[model samples]
Target chain A: MATGLKIKTAAELRTNYLRREMFPTIFCDGCGLGNVLNYTLWAIDEVGLDLDRTVFVSGIGCSSRLPGYINADGLHATHGRALAFASGIRAANPDLTVIVFTGDGDGAGIGGNHLLHTIRRNMDVTVILVNNFTYGMTGGQSAPTTPDGGFSSTTPYGNIEHPLDICELAKALGAPYVARWPVVSPAQPVKSIAEGIRKRGFALIEMLTPCPTAYGRRNGLKEIEQIWRWYREHTVLLDEWEWVEQFGSPEEREALRGKLKIGVFQDTERETFEDRWAALVAREKL
Target chain B: MHTIQIDEGWCKGCALCVIYCPTRALQVAARFSPRGVHPPELVRPERCNGCRLCELLCPDFAITVTEEGRVHA
Candidate 1:
């Protein structure tokens, strides 16, 4: 929503980026997948990525369906193995940009081990993980990213376990870039995604999007605006939180509990998986 | 000047466009699409400042706001 920035025409974007035959997407009304996808395409446009050379990879989930809608070379990979598939693609062709779309269940739940290994290797891929706190494609089951006390179909009495912070996990695993953003606003996410795509090694962008049909109704957020309002109310920038942690009292830090600390958590340079592989190949040849 | 265009066939009437419109220029119309949901309509074109909030928030990619008119009223 930044003013004065060059905005692409809808017709042009649809013709160039989206698969027009797939119009009227299957996402439920008020769902945030559209927002996530829009920000992603905007990011690709901003970074001037060559779509012909970019490959999209995804696993089984609502968010994973993203690749099928875009007019690009993509693999609708198996369940919980998008990163595994993407790593193979990256190893085969280091020059092509590999982007992975995954949901909380697909990325953090069944695929958590693969995610860790992929980050540990510092694979040359950009991961866009949409965490809606529930298995939106599978009937509102509780997901690894579901907040404590969150209500899902499987957790009728409310969830007891704490949520997994994907950004913290990725940063701990030494990803080259990690960021998180709520889907309420597109400006920050669009910019962050663009930056992630430009990074050299593993880049993870966790998007807290709303699944109004699966997750919202049970959580008393039947309205999409309410979810947006909740994001505006319950989220804080990580930089601001860090500043407060450094300068403010313990009580001030305590107030941050349950508040989603979003924004770029880390961005550092590192040799990517392909670089290591190339060195190994040359040394072996010698 | 600004103009709002909505693809009624594409719109699912989630009303994110209607609710996010800064000037209240868009509203959910009573008529339903073949999809059975009422689509949002541009009710007040003159009030729009081309913010594109509706365009960005719209889950359906239904709304598009464009700068229009070369002269002021």
Candidate 2:
């Protein structure tokens, strides 16, 4: 709310939203962390959230390093404990806008238990999980989100285990808002994230980002552009898939064997944990 | 008329903006930046239609498309 007819430039927006001192990010040349951060900032701007009131939190991982680059108050917590730390911050100050950044390995592997309970509680917070398939920061280690038969440092023989579908799990756990989008497309993610930020209860946005140096180099995607193109080619909209399932021929349905589903898995209104806690506090009159 | 601004220090020269530009106005410069990567340059400023696609798709937040009419304090 500064002045008349001021259309903020991207550079201006970056200066206002990000820590300029932290420029020249440590992320590899083709890494998608920059895209994720860029989209998140765009969402924040679209929603007109007060930067001073917002709090960013993250645990250990390549994605976790994002909050430190943001301009707002941030907490760089222990490995796989970002959700726990974010919950504490929200509970202590319910008025603040709390957002947590986490990676696939940090959120779905060691932090899996916390993720379940947090969604079940329906805490008022926004969680952005950047799923790069492998633990990119740790040199291409296989993660819980790594696709079946995907190669990683630990999975040189090909990952035999099935990947964890965090979006489906969050939907079953009753998270108020949940969605997944690959970093190749920014417009959908920006809109979805803006909606998630405006929603009251637990909001989770899982982004499939490229880790060219680590994941892509090992996998078939040798270049960064190949990763984006792969996402574009592999992803199928949920509605389209449903139509294909109900009406399309067996051959047509069989054609979608390895395609990834992308869209808002769940979005429902619910009483948040903070509201319930406030009610109890009032009833007890302590 | 719109002018394209590129933050030389911040750009990693991913060419995402270059590839996504609708007007084909952006191209990676032959000269390297301080970061040793070739930064994208606005080769044909007149061809830019203010689509802001490059602005939105820039991974590093290095590019900004602004018009001549807008005033900033």
Question: Against the true structure, what is each candidate's TM-score?
Answer: 0.94, 0.94
User: Tens digit of lDDT per residue, candidate 2, span B1-73?
Assistant: 7878788898999998887787899898999999889999888988988888887777787888888776332
Candidate 2 DockQ score?
0.61
Chain A TM-score, each candidate: 0.95, 0.95
Candidate 2's C-alpha runs over 4 A off are A1-8, B68-73
Colliding pairs, model 2:
none
Share of reference contacts kept by candidate 2: 0.57
Task: Highest DockQ: give the candidate number.
Answer: 2
Q: Among all windows of ten consecutive residues in candidate 1 chain A, which has the lowest summed lDDT?
A: A1-10
Clashes of each: 0, 0
Q: Tell me the lDDT of model 1 at B53.
A: 81
Docking class of 2: medium
Residues A166-259, model 2: lDDT tens digits: 9999999999999999888777888788889999999999998888888988988978678778888888888998999999999979988877
Output the lDDT of residue A146, model 2. 89
Fraction of native contacts under 8 Å reproduced by each candidate: 0.52, 0.57
